[model samples]
Each structure stands twice: as structure tokens, then as C-alpha cells.
Target: MEQLLDEFRSTMDIPWSIWSARLVGTVVLCGLIGFEREVDKRQAGIRTHILVGLASALYCIVMQHLVVSDEFATDRVRTDPIRVVEAVTQGVAFLAAGLVVFHQGNVRGLKTGATMWLSAAIGLACGLGLWGLAVTTTIIAIVIIVLFRKIEQKAGTHVPGHKNAGEKEA
Candidate 1:
């Protein structure tokens, strides 16, 4: 009884303001990338991106609470935070794999899948209170998706048999 109370209290020690900031950051940063995808008419859009980002952020927050609560145990079980990160990556990879498709000798969704993976990473960073990292990464991803595509088209690099890009997987 007392043990449960102590664990609960420990977890609740985190400030609500901090929690709100992380969650909001995850949404905004991930949304920017998602909006890019929406503009491109990709399958995954703003809602999907926001959902992934929010879920990832929630998982990280849960992990944080668990870690804090673990401290109140009589037998403090040391946890490797890396494990939580690995778990998140594995889950995100599963989602990313779903976004990819191969058809007509022209692979599609690879970029979208990669974007999903990036969204997860950004969400994780936001959840972990790395606002700058999340923001910078979002900006870089937007540039790669938006500006790079323009550059590729202008250079005719994205066309099949173009010099810049190799043949997609058969």
C-alpha cells in the first residue's frame, strides 16, 4: 500500500508544464513534416503523422514516469533507458515498413516510410526534452523532402534512368 503510494507520488513529481511542453512540441514538429507529406499527396498525411508523434511522445513520457517511480522501490531495479528507446524504434520500424510499397518496377513510399521513421525520432526527442534537436531535425527533414525534390526535378535526377538516382529495386 505504502509502496504503491510512494511510486505514484514519485511519478507525479514531474511538473505538468514540462509534460505539456513536450507533448505540444512533438505535435508541432511532427506536424510540419506531415504537412509536407500531405502536400505531396502521399498516403500518410497530417493526421497520421500527428498520431504517430503523439503516441511516441506518450510512450516516452510513460517511460520517464516509470523510471522515476522505480526509484521508490525497496529493491530498486535498475533499468536501461536504451531498452525503451530500442522498443520505440522497433515499433516505429514496423509502422514504417507498412508505408513502403514496391510495384511496377518503380518503388514508391520509400520516402514516406523514411519520413515516418523520422517522425518517430523527432517525437522521441521532443518527449525527452530535446526541443532544439527536434526542431532542427524537423527543419532538415522539411528541406530534404520539399527543396530536394524540387532540385531533383529541376536536374531531371528523379526520372527513371537518370544519372543522379539509380534504378529502384526490381
Candidate 2:
């Protein structure tokens, strides 16, 4: 059993500690962003966001490892990380489409859909070993979702369409 474990660990080609740290950090960052979405009561809230982010990060890590291995074995390996980003963006678009609702002549969930897109980007950053950027971006996203929301509400009241029906229009 120990031999199998050792072999498996060695085959990964990355330090176990670093891999674990990256995984945990990615998960936590995803959860933080998800939590903010949950507070907003969006359709794709905590679990959905976290799952998407984690899966994106995992896919990136696996692709990177495969690319590196192919290079070491002198095989024809194309190292195009942007492909992963493109794929993730496409997939997130599908997810975002589901979150959109057209009713009462109003469009809802657009911001939530955008948030989902951003979350996937953060996951990609984490997957590409950009832990600091991912963490920083996640923090910024949280602030935008939480703090900026209040400011937007207050500011929106002054906008023509957002005012009460009695308000005069220019």
C-alpha cells in the first residue's frame, strides 16, 4: 500500500505540499466568491460557483502536467494554455445562459452571470499557479459585490428610469 502511494505521489511530478496548498487555496478563494453570490440570492450561488471554480482549476492543473510530461518525453506537445481559458469561458457562457431570466420586461441575473464568468477566470488563474493574483482578485470581487452594491442602489435612485413614476423626466 505504501509503495503504491509513493509511486502515485511521485508520478504527479509536483511536490505534494505545494499541490495541496494550491488546491486548498483555490477552494477557499472559490468559496469566498461563492459566498458573496449566495448573499445576493443568485441562482448559481455558493455550491455552483465553488464547483465551477474548482473544476476549472483542476482541469488547468491536469493539462499543464500533461503538457510538461509530453515535453519531457520529447513528444509533440502544444503548450497553449489559452485554449483552457477559451474552453472555460465557453462552458461558463452556457452556465450563465441558464441563470438569465426574461420576465416583466426586465432582465435579471446579468450581473450574476458576469460574476460567474469572473469566478471561472479566477479559477484559471489559480490553476495556472497564479495564487497571489487569484487571491487578490477574489478579494476585490467580494468587495465589489458587497460594498459596491449598496453604492449602486443609492446611485440608481437618481437615474431617470429608476425613480418613482411621479418623478419628472427631461
Candidate 3:
């Protein structure tokens, strides 16, 4: 059993230390962003955000390891990691589409959808060992999602497009 575990770890090509760090960091980042969404009662809150981030990070690690393997190395082999980014973006678009609703002329969950996309990007950064970037981006995203909403609401009164609450536009 121990041998099998060791072999599996080796196949993943991540040192246990680094893997543990990545896991913790990804979870923290996801939770931080998710907490903001949860406070706003968003649909894709804690679990959804964490799952997306962790899965994307894992996928990135696997893809990178495979591309760098000895057997796959060729004299002219070209492996562009951007392909992974593109694929993840395309796939996440489908997830985002599902969050959109056509009823009542109200579009909800758009921020949640965007949060998922950013979570995935953070995960990719974590997978590539860019801890500083991932952490900074997560903090910035949280601030934007939480703090900016309040600012926008307060400033809405003075903004031209936003009329007083009880007043209808002419």
C-alpha cells in the first residue's frame, strides 16, 4: 500500500511538500473569494468556487507534467501552456452561460460566473507555483467583489444614469 502511494505520488511529478502547499493555498484563495460571494448570497459560493479552483490547478499540473515527460520530449516538440488556458476559458464559458437567466429582464449570477473564471485563473497560478501572484489576485478580487459593490450603491444616487429609487425615468 505504501509503495503504491509512493508510485502514484511520483507519477504526479509533484513533491509532497509543494503539493501540500499548493493544496492549502488553493483552498485558502478559494475560500476567501467564496466568502465574499456567500455574504452576497450568490449561487456559486464556497463549494463551487473551491472545486473549480482546485480542479483547474490539478489539471494544469497534470498537463504540464505530461508535456515535460521524457517519453513525450521530441526534438521539434512544441508544448504551449497557453493551450491549456484557452481550453479552460472555453469550457468555463459554458459554465458561465448556465448562470445567465432570460426571465424578467434581469441578469443574475454574472458576477458569480466571473468569480468562477477568476478562481480558475488563480488555480492555474497556484499550479505553476506563482504563489505571490495568486495570493495578490485573490485579495484584489475579493475587494472588488465586496467593497466595490457598496461604493457603487452609495454613488448611484449622484450618477446620471441612476435615478432616485422612487423616481421613474422620463
Predicted candidate 2 versus true structure: per-residue lDDT over 30-110, tens digit per residue:
888778778766667778877888878877887777777744556454577678888999999899888777755756677
Which ten contiguous residues of candidate 3 have the minimum total lDDT?
A: 157-166
List of clashing residue pairs for candidate 1: none
For model 3, what is the error of residue 38's alpha carbon versus the real structure, in angstroms, after optimal superposition?
A: 1.3
Candidate 3 error regions (>4 Å): 1-12, 75-78, 153-170
Q: List candidate 1 stretches off by more than 4 Å.
A: 1-11, 70-76, 157-170
Error of 1 at 101 (Å): 1.3
TM-scores of the candidates in the order shown: 0.82, 0.79, 0.80
Against the correct fold, how does model 3 do in TM-score?
A: 0.80
What are the Cα lDDT values of the candidates?
Answer: 0.80, 0.76, 0.78
Candidate 2 residue spans exceeding 4 A from truth: 1-10, 71-79, 155-170
lDDT of 1 by residue, 28-141 (tens): 998999998887777888888888888888888878887777454546577567777788889888988986766656567787778888888898998889888999999988
RMSD of each: 5.5, 5.6, 5.3
- Candidate 1 lDDT at 67 equals 74
Ranking by TM-score: 1, 3, 2
Model 3 alpha-carbon miss at residue 41, Å:
1.0
TM-score: which candidate is best? 1
Question: Which is the winner by TM-score between candidate 1 and candidate 2?
Answer: 1
